[model samples]
Target: MSKNSSTATGTSVSSRILLDAVTKHYPGQSKPAVDGITLEIPAGKIVMLVGPSGCGKTTTLKMINRLIEPTEGRITLGDEDVTNIDGDQLRRRMGYVIQAGGLFPHMTVAANIAIVPKMLGWSKEKIKNRVDELLELVSLEPAMYRDRYPRELSGGQQQRVGVARALAADPPVLLMDEPFGAVDPITRQRLQDELLRIQEEVQKTIVFVTHDFDEAVKLGDWIVVFSEGAHIVQYDTPERILNEPASSFVEDFIGAGAGLKQLTLNRVRDVELAEAVTGSPGEMAQDVLARVKEAGDGHAVILDENRRPLSWPSRRQLSRLETIPATPDAAIPLVTQGSTLSDALDTMLVSSAGAALVTDRRRSFVGVITVEVVMEAITRSRKASAMANDNDSPVGTNTGTIEVQGGTT
Candidate 1:
């Protein structure tokens, strides 16, 4: 997502990790929580560990921190043996967020966020600066929320503050355990979007735990699917898992309607459409006739030099109305290059707009997304999904992670 990084998957050499013959055992159980798991995690990648409850997915992740020490095997962080490092020091260098926004009962949001920096011996001024910065990073106003106590905030706010706290020190290695799981579904989605945004800004090495396959697919650079006792069933990109489904277990986990789900993930650019309708407000009503004749479908997008939309004036607007009203805000959402065809459909549904005014990021209209375009995008997405499933293609780099200036790590 960073401008400097061509690979949006967030990979870098410094954050790579490796697990060699990793195994963990509980005191009373004869079976291991983790059983001989060997995995390679490229740096700056988010590898999601997902499965049903008590599947040992969480246990396998915790072993990276010695939270649950491995009874056998080596854990390496960028070629350094993490097993030899002190647990506290190792944890301090790793950003961690839990589902509940684990704030101290007695601390203000600012203080809660400052805990890690304070532990790492940051000056008071530095910690204050970071607290304010993180609040903004998480889309919260620092002045109104920083001094507030955890009890005074909503669950969503609490979660944001917790994320601010975890990211305070800008550690390269991040561990998240169902970090958005505690909030309501709507709030959880917002949090997920925010996480994706922040992850783009900060290209950290992330190992995340989740029970939800959708969440894993949405966030993972690569997903590591596990069975009971931390046995790996499959490890690959989200697209690959969905399309290829290494085994019946993985396919069954995705369930039906996967084609629809995959549609949301692919972008419009993945497919193409016919030239769209175009027109001008003041153009000779007769000119509309010639243009409509040329387009064959009987329409043309009216454009200003800037290409901001004016209207999709019906032939009725010209024939029935005395004058066409040109209002900028009245038009549908200005669809951008980054938006998926699915996004265009969503905007159309919400606005009841017959077409999307497709634009460049600069807001200059490039083309339009008409009913034809929408249908084409959907058809293309479904076809791609089917092909991907047939070939087991990897679902990597489906998103754009925009870097925020001055983002740490």
Candidate 2:
């Protein structure tokens, strides 16, 4: 059977998901798999549940959509109790994703993404439009991938399709359980970055479960750290969790260098980027070199007509050569304004350029990010973290339920 699209209308609506004293127990098990756990997942934000294996993290997540019913306590979607709701109906209101995409082996990618919309009786034209939108949302080109089966795609591509499927219905809430766990480390990191990018636009209340603290820190707006038996050790923002662990249990769980980890929260836009010499194709090599020398960076970034980055010209080509190469086609890495300092560092390292061109949403040139710039931002953030009060209240705990209102593509 093919997966179904979400039945939710394609609107940007979200509700604060609440788990009040949530507990789960097996028939023969003496102790509860998930002990008394009360946590508030704010609307339109990512809440990560992280801990060791068998820590009940996954069980807690499943309980939200009632995939695995809790033996005691109430789960609320906004102000409505989910425990008393119809299982099928409740699931239709939320999107669920698991490891390895969990796509139907027999279905094409478009079919998998359209399943929920079709089940909800969406018109063929509407479903088709949504399939294309979601594929683009997840960075999968719709025209290229819509007809492909799961077997034909790589693990990362399949995971993207799975994400596209989950978002097909535009559900207000999304539950992900180790969704990127099965991919290679590099692919996993890219997925994490992509997820953050998607969240910025969709703003669904996301509950993500992962064992990797790094992933948790990277993606979580707020994090709930679970100990043995699903007991909560700490529930707070990523910054608070990194800067101030609630207890020794939390401190131990978070491990060392918490401050360093906090750098991921700081974005490239937060720091001052250095001005770089820039030129367009067909510019005189002598002119470009003169500008580069004036800027004292000894390098020039060439831009296209749309102001998007093209390549970094070699200092040798500029300083000792003739007119700029007519077919300038060298590789230069790029980072967006929303890119975190950690992401910038990764780009620099991978590109071996020690610097990356930063751009805005319109793909226009913004500035450049270097390792030194990232380091400065981190140093400033660390000092701020040190002076910040650990007792300050966390973000997104404003109320039991947040009323989210916006438009959805």
- Output the number of the lDDT-best candidate: 2
TM-score of candidate 2 against the unseen true structure = 0.81
Error of 2 at 209 (Å): 1.0
Off by over 4 Å in 1: 1-11, 267-376, 386-409
Mind giving the per-residue lDDT tens digits that candidate 1 earns over 134-167? 9998889899999999999989999999888888
- Across 1-409, the per-residue lDDT of candidate 2 in tens digits comes to 0010011212232477877777799999988898766666778888898988898999989999988999988888888899889998899889999999999999999999998898899999999999999998888889999999999999999999999898888898999999998998657766786788889888899999998887888888777777777766566667766765656677777788777777778777888887888888877888898888877786888888988787777678777767655464545677777767787888888888888888875557898888888777778877787667554765322122322111011
Error of 1 at 206 (Å): 1.0
Error of 2 at 281 (Å): 6.6
Candidate 2 Cα outliers beyond 4 Å, as residue runs: 1-14, 278-295, 302-307, 317-332, 362-364, 385-409
Model 2: which residue pairs collide? 4-115, 4-116, 5-115, 5-116, 5-117
C-alpha TM-score for every candidate: 0.71, 0.81
Clashing residue pairs in candidate 1, if any? 239-395, 243-389, 277-300, 277-301, 278-300, 278-301, 279-300, 279-301, 279-302
**Pairing residues by index, what is the TM-score of model 1?**
0.71
